[model samples]
Target: MKFTTKWMAAYFPEYKGAADTEIPIHHIYTDTRQKTDRGLFVPLEGETFDGHSFLKSAINNGAVAAFWNKEKPIPEFVPTDFPLFLVDDTLIALQQLAHTFRTEINPKVIGVTGSNGKTTTKDFIASVLSQNYKTHKTKGNFNNHIGLPLTILSMDQTTEVLVLEMGMNHFGEIERLSFISEPDVAVITNIGESHIENLGSREGIAQAKTEILAGLKSNGKVIIDGDEPLLAPLHTREGVLSCGFDEKNKFVLSDCKMDDTGTRFTINQNINYMIQVPGNHNVKNASFAIIIGELLNMNQEHIQEGLSSIELTGMRLERITGKYGTTILNDAYNASPTSMKASIDVVKELPNFSRKILVLGDIFELGALSEMLHRSIADAISEPIDMVIAIGEEAPYIVEEMKKKELAIEAHSFKTKEEAVDILESTLSEETVILLKASRLMEFETLLEHLVEKE
Candidate 1:
């Protein structure tokens, strides 16, 4: 059980009915459609919908208590004895409750933020830390203001480590999440171009990402990318450990190797590590986990075990066997110029693929730099890459740039994913490997529905 109604009453005293009852609340839910066990329903208001209207559905789905907006009238249907905590803003009340619950459980919080690999890094950290601790991590894309609180509130009382992936599109967002999480360990994966349109430049992005430090506990540990020039200022800070391929980092990575299976690398020229995912970028992400494991005094054996058995979120460099034995690298969860290029490089390095095709799509939030940034992806495409099938509005720039190179590779452009599905299906074969990448708006995973081999 998470907490009792009596326990929650201590935090929210302005409530009516059953305030003294010891009814257990095992879950906290927002969506009325999701069934819960003794849940506390939080009615959230959005642009097009108000969850307040569905309190009856929440009640039918096992919501024992709920937070009602003070502006809304107590519905005539609501039982007079049912617990209803009145609040001016249900969202803020939810956040405050989560903060109190987090303090009560008192897990060692780890806040991870970066342009690209925050989710993957959160997975790595949680996997490694769970080897020696009762760990809980942010689920799916639940890293925003609402999602982070829900993630915290969802954790069991026994959790010893709380791993949160923090995401943002503008400034001050990470600061708000950091303050809510109050992490003991803050990790800045790397400074990339993920939200350059809103943040302005790589430096601005770094500033926004580093807002995770705003709520860091005194004497807390900080992990960062030593290779990123924007984060170089923190290289010498007390209790800060930098991890990267650069020799100057506190935890240096080298001797990296990748193949069809995964990546192998060594840290500080002594400890060797292997992860089931292939890419130098992944190596850096794994290094952040290794540093955290060491800081927590985990044995090298457990760290290795964690990395070897790591399971990533879907649509992230996932390898699938397609029709006619074709290989599909679905990195289509989301994309930016930096990540798209990184995905392209991973495909370029893999061996034994006679036909390597790139099914590229537009990257969003690029603002005025969309054309130039899309064109820059072609810089990573060269020899051994047999075909480039570009789709979406700005993705055609990638093909246009490749055509300027006049290489022997086949390059095609289509305005939409539907237009390219037939060509992608025909190109699949035993020797061919295809990489699919795009922004979340592109819904590139739908393309997989047509390409994945069905039983």
Candidate 2:
């Protein structure tokens, strides 16, 4: 964010005043409510509201300048001498400015995308690389079209490595992100049914995830999950690095073990590694980080140190103590059938717990196959699981399937999390370990709060 308005005018020549102004813009802001100090406000136009309306508010809040949409009328209150970059579209201008800044900084960019685990994978890669290099990564939920550009723009010029998470609900979204990033190393976590509502099927999801390759550097390397049959076509491609439990993968994860403490696994059958995060999926996530570390020429000791001291984003299988002395695995950040099963598997693996409870919720965006997909989770549940509390509109499908199986487990279905909370408040105890998981809309994390407050 060290660019000047003079530099920005080079890409966007149409400006109202003072193209040679020496204003150093250290921040790019979109939201007017946020504090904007020496910031350049880029007004984005949406279906419901136009950001152009907030230009004056942004300027009042410390924005040095703004990007004005040419289609909109200029406010008569504003002076002509005030700095404004007139563009056909403010959103496109923001992207163009971000691209220009990225080219100038010239850091080694890594783009991560998938149906699940994109955020965790990005965090893992950034943590490992930061041990040896000045690394910057996407913060918070900023991994989309606007988020990605802002992530790049937010990076320090001295950053040696940049890791960005790419998220998409439909086709071509990843392509646009990739084109902006031009990644030197692209990692596809795995193909799942996350956006099956819009993308059609697992095959369609795979195709959409592969769009990350659209802007990959000519000599870039691709790291993927070889265990997925949908990605089998990439097994033989040059510069493609595969990591998974499958033997065919170039970097195979073997001899795995997990507990409440963490997970231990071997890479390539010889190198031992441990990550603080639970679940086999997280172990696979660390494997991708290991590959990226190696490609960056980081030594094994440094990489292992990085892996052992991993800092993950919150609500991804995080083990927290409950008010009742029970354990709460707050993994309610997001859910897909694959991720929900993975989280459940982690719950089952934790030892010393007398009762393992799974408070599950709906997985969104499954299209017409939502019911069948929701029921499919039953295939993963087994013994050691004492109770299953399904929440949300589509979660009852899981309960129905569980009942049909007739397993020796208690199952209850609730239309809302509020109803589920009443049962959990009385049921949870010191020996209980409960997992809360669902899509972002379900807000399953609030249930964990209720458990903590009851005591």
Candidate 3:
């Protein structure tokens, strides 16, 4: 990012510094621990940690400048002539800088958001768009407020297409990110019971997710999951393209087939598509990318290559071999009731596994409906799953509900991951496929590691 020190004056006019020199800032950094060179450090204040405490470390680690909160006293460690963009809040200043940089570069931005498939869809869109354009997308799971700005600032000046993942837990969050991104094209993957605790119901969740349309460009197009009844309101909206298995969708999904390797599907019988990732849901995720690719005028061959060559973000159904010759589907990145069921459905479809084991943990943030949502996962379990190993505070309810329903699947529940591992390791075999999925707080990756290491 080539930003002049003088340019900072535009967003922060009160920025007290020499405005003559055009200093090029190569990077923008928040965490002092991460290695940075000639970067602008933006100190943020939070409840548990204060980034202002790390300013000296940031400067020592090669930060050429920083955004200084005007309310806070200037630290003495800095030289009198050092560049400090002064603002009321450093975090807001960082956002302002990113917004300014975005305007200067003026890349076509695509915003993607959903309860389950945001990361996968972002990867799909980026992979496909990058085949034809200089594309940059949200890195990892950094889709929140701070992460979104950081993503924008991190983009190269030459970037032609910018794909951003907009994530939220409550109202107004997506609206803030949408306004910040000013997306030329917006995609809402689906609205599910992700943050029912805060959003109340599926209707409320849908309301929160639709905030992406707030800052959508007047001429921008919208692609959505038409199968969702909650999204039916978007059906008649102008410039909105719907993609789903439903025939009512503009790009109808059809003839989906999946195995251990991947998924093959067709859209409207006009194009046949395949994804390296397995899941009917992932095929849905790929459908969003396909629509975006067409909107960008990318050719069919390039679009095919992009979807077929997808590399999903870590821990999202990542395949790994266990020490006992078991196949581990490490989807511990995150989980909502909807996502959990989707993962379970994918595991059910995989062929050649003699035994299918589902290691599910609690789906957090369900509010009053936590138990109900937890119990709903049991509905997805059947003969395809030989055993269900559940861990977490809410997991026992799953086992209880399954027993009540007499699902006929062997089930076990543990309050902690440590307790579950012993039984999990004992059951592993050459034909076993274990799927670990939970909320990020559960840290189920540790179980994945244990299974991978156990002989």
Per-residue CA lDDT of model 2 for 13-54, tens digit only, reads 888867568788989979999887789899999999999898
State every prediction's TM-score relative to the real structure. 0.97, 0.98, 0.97
TM-score between model 2 and native? 0.98
lDDT of 2: 0.90
Candidate 3: TM-score? Answer: 0.97
TM-score of 1: 0.97
Each candidate: what lDDT? 0.92, 0.90, 0.89
> Model 2 clash pairs?
none
Weakest lDDT window of 10 consecutive positions for candidate 3: 12-21
Q: Supply the global lDDT for candidate 3.
A: 0.89
Q: Name the Cα RMSD for model 3.
A: 1.5
Question: Which of candidates 1 and 3 reaches a greater lDDT?
Answer: 1
Candidate 3 C-alpha lDDT tens digits along 1-455: 56767677666776544533577678998999987767888989999988888988998898877888887788887877678877888877777777778888999999999888999999999999999999999999889999999999999989999999999989999999998899999999988899899999999999999899999999999999999999999989999999999898899999998866688899898789888888989999998998999998999899999987777799999999897788999999989999999999989999999899999999889999999999988899898899999898998898999999988899999999999878898888889999999999999998866787754
Query: Each model's RMSD to truth, in Å?
Result: 1.2, 1.3, 1.5
